[model samples]
Target: MAKSNERRTNIFPLALVTLTGLFLVNLLGFIDTQTGSAFGCGRDWPLCNGKIIPEVWNTHVAIEFIHRLVVLADLLLLLFLIAATYRRYRGRKDIRILMGISFLAFSGEGVLGAISVLTDNPPSVLALHMGMSLIAFTSLYLWTATLRQIETGKYQRFDLQDASSVKQLRKWTWGTLIYSFLVVYFGAYVTFTGAGGYFQGWPFPTESYSQAKTALLIDLTHRLMALILFVLILRLFLFTFRLRGKREDLRAVSLQTLILVVFQMLSGALLIITKLNLIAFLLHVSIATFMVGSLGLLGLKASSLQEKERMKEYNL
Candidate 1:
């Protein structure tokens, strides 16, 4: 129990480290967008405007240029983490799997990034690129948590005999994650399509509602998903309360998910109401990133519980 408590305490800090890296990446992207530097490099892959080093230091050039460096830093950090954790927890399949996923997702993020630049920063491509980065970051969070578990020797497998509840939570969690990605994608679309400027006068567009409608639809879908997820989480928490001592870990994960989801929804709504103000935008993206990480953690907990239950049934 002492070891488990120690691991639980350490997990938050480690997760925060990974979250910091993700926040940096998100900030870089936001800076690029705010400065209209999406095409600053002029369709060059791994190069700044087709040169290893640009002789100029214009705003667009600087934003795009620095974003590249930030991505490089993130990649290196993830690689170092994988290497260090694998060396220490070489025998653990869970840790190995998490590391492998993180590496693969990082590689995919690099490819998507290159494609975004090569395609002249197409909206769809850019959106997908951000989505891929989020996946990589989520994997890193899971891996970091797993490493903490190993360090404190709190890595116990679960036995979840009530498969129905497990299945329900899994479905809801997965659905929420997917819907959140779509929200991000549409947000990118709004920026790239310049639809975000529709309400320049605030509240409503004076001329046409087309742009407003599209943005509203995107926002509404995200909001509906948030509501559904909240209900699902509340139900899960209530069920866990009934189960009490039997599923303490699962209950903890459920509560965390609920808290993060609520915050994410609020942040997103505030961003829009504030007219996409820079500070709110940053916080909005940060909360969304946190939500993704939380969802990933919940998924892992659920899967582990299911596996344990299956093993127990087989042994019986």
Candidate 2:
């Protein structure tokens, strides 16, 4: 019993470390992509330039190699977390579900990365790689945040007493998350497709080369979707802010989401104005990733709290 208690006590910090590692790996992977270094290791998987370590060091090789190393370390951390969670919280279906997702996403990300290296990383594959990394990162994040909430006893206040309201908020938050993810994905797709270069203006394409009409159209659609996402996030924030007295957690998450969306818009404009500058591009995608993850956290909490209300109503 004492050992189990000790393990539970340590879980939150361990999860936090693992989550941070995953986030760093995702950022490094994007850096690798943005730097056009995917082929740096010369179509090698689990090896750098046909060796465990590269015989030659160049900027591209260094970036890709470092990304792979970070991925390896993060995967080890995730595996340890999985084992710990199984031993300590095996009966927790939510924790188990999150672990399952984190495992699958990380695995998929690795496989995709390998395939991308082998295939020269076509635009679609590269985009999917980013998407998988985000999924893995978000799952671990959710797991860690859940542990923190439980440890701090903050989850107890999730009982809003009104199950219907919880359900409504959960649905709305989730729906918005889905839309935000689509927008993010399309933005990535636009980037990888090389369509972002055809646009000459922010919020609208001022001029288009004759051969780049499709690129222009795609970029325009991406901008429109972003506008709609901003409105959705704004509405979500207003609604949650009104309920601040009841669920400060949700209100805070909504505020964060709103702030991220605003920054995302600004970053988008920067990307356009700078003609897809690497820093601006990273900021745009990174903010969108966290924004979607924040909404996911909000929805998951409400969903869990709503379940508690259900059990209470049924006298379980």
Predicted structure 1: lDDT: 0.66
Name the candidate that leads on lDDT: 2
Give the worst 10-residue stretch by lDDT in candidate 1.
1-10
Error of 2 at 219 (Å): 0.3
- Indicate the residue-level lDDT of 314 in model 2: 31
Instruction: List per-prediction Cα lDDT, in the order shown.
Output: 0.66, 0.81
> After aligning candidate 2 to the native by TM-score, how far in Å is the CA of 211 from where it should be?
6.5
State every prediction's TM-score relative to the real structure.
Answer: 0.77, 0.92
lDDT of 1 by residue, 125-168 (tens): 77777777777777778777665544554544444476677677
Off by over 4 Å in 2: 1-7, 156-161, 209-211, 305-316
Cα error, candidate 1, residue 217 (Å)? 4.0
